[model samples]
Target: MGILERLSRLIRANLNDLIRRAEDPEKIIEQALEDMRAALREARMEVAEAMAELRKLEREQQSYAEQAAAWERKAAEALKAEREDLAREALKRKQQAQALAEGFAQQVAQQQALVNQLTTQLKALESKIQESEARKALLIARKKGVEAAETVRRFESKVDAHSAVEAFDEMERRIEAMEDKHKALAELDRNDIEKELERLDANRQVEEDLNRLKRELGLA
Candidate 1:
């Protein structure tokens, strides 16, 4: 594994505490899961590298072993031809090849162990990330639920405040309408009084004109 993988494991270890302390736990948890994915990617790269190294070591071991076998065959051929000096030289080559192969054999064992270790670590990290993903879904659901409840609470308050303002506006409008109606009635009453006074003045003028005509005819 690498630094990112190590850091992810550390974050996962303290996930619950981190959630509790964060103001926005939803974002925090999401970022945490993202980090986990990064770690998994890093781990996969390491495993790939280890596999490549293992394969290289295998090839090296096979090459050395093949050289050793070829050298041994050459030695046998030299002996059969009764060439003692050539046989000794071939034997020496065989020993050198054998020694190289032996060295590779030790290294191959070490590389195989390393490959196994890396594979195991990768599997474990993958499992951990999977489990965390499952938990993250649950956390997201909870966050959404909480946010919905809060929205409902705010909406209810907003409606309540709107209703109060609406009622106050309606009452003011009603009061204005009532005052206008009363003012119109009072205006009608004043107009009727003016008409009555005009009627009395016309009647008085007619009575005075009748008296003047009667006096002119000497019947006042």
Candidate 2:
């Protein structure tokens, strides 16, 4: 019946529609802002139309008042000129004009009230849209943060400590084998050196024995 009533219904319907969708928070906030903007646009148009209608009603009221005054003067002139029948007719017309003027006055008051209400609603809708836009930015930041955390989680899950340990164990075994081979080579070298020294010592001992024999067998 009125702009205020229609605005209330639209607001409720938008909220209910959002709830029914049950979507992501970011999406929900975005949709809510769009709905508010649409509602604001509609409210502006309604207020404009109501203001126009109110102005029209005021003009009609003024016209009716002027006609009533004119008819009243005509009625008085008829009475002064001794024409009761003409006076009665003019009086009836005056009353009718007065009644119509009063009706337009009432309509103007009602329309003005509606226009005021629609304007207030439009402002409120603008305020809500501003707040929702800020919230949407915050929501997008939070969603990005969540995505980054999920990526880190996936990377951590793919890394395996057991595999790293197995790789190190293989390298360690290869080093141990190399060390064992070096120790074996060093022991062989030491043995070879000791045998050569023993051979030299034996040769020196034999020479000494031959020299003693020659000395004992000598005539002079």
* Every model: Cα RMSD to truth: 8.2, 7.4
Question: Candidates' lDDT values, in order?
Answer: 0.84, 0.85
Error of 1 at 153 (Å): 4.7
Report the lDDT of model 2 for residue 19: 78
Give lDDT: candidate 1, residue 159.
83
* Model 2 residue 72 lDDT score: 95
Cα-lDDT of candidate 2? 0.85
Off by over 4 Å in 1: 1-23, 152-220
lDDT of residue 143 for candidate 1: 87
Give the 10-residue window scoring lowest on summed lDDT in candidate 2. 1-10
TM-score of 1: 0.63
* lDDT by residue (tens digit), candidate 2, 1-220: 5544676577668777877887676766676677677777887888898899999999999999999999999999999999999999999999999999999999999998888887887777777678878878888999989989999988777664468867898999999999999999999999999999999999899988888888888822
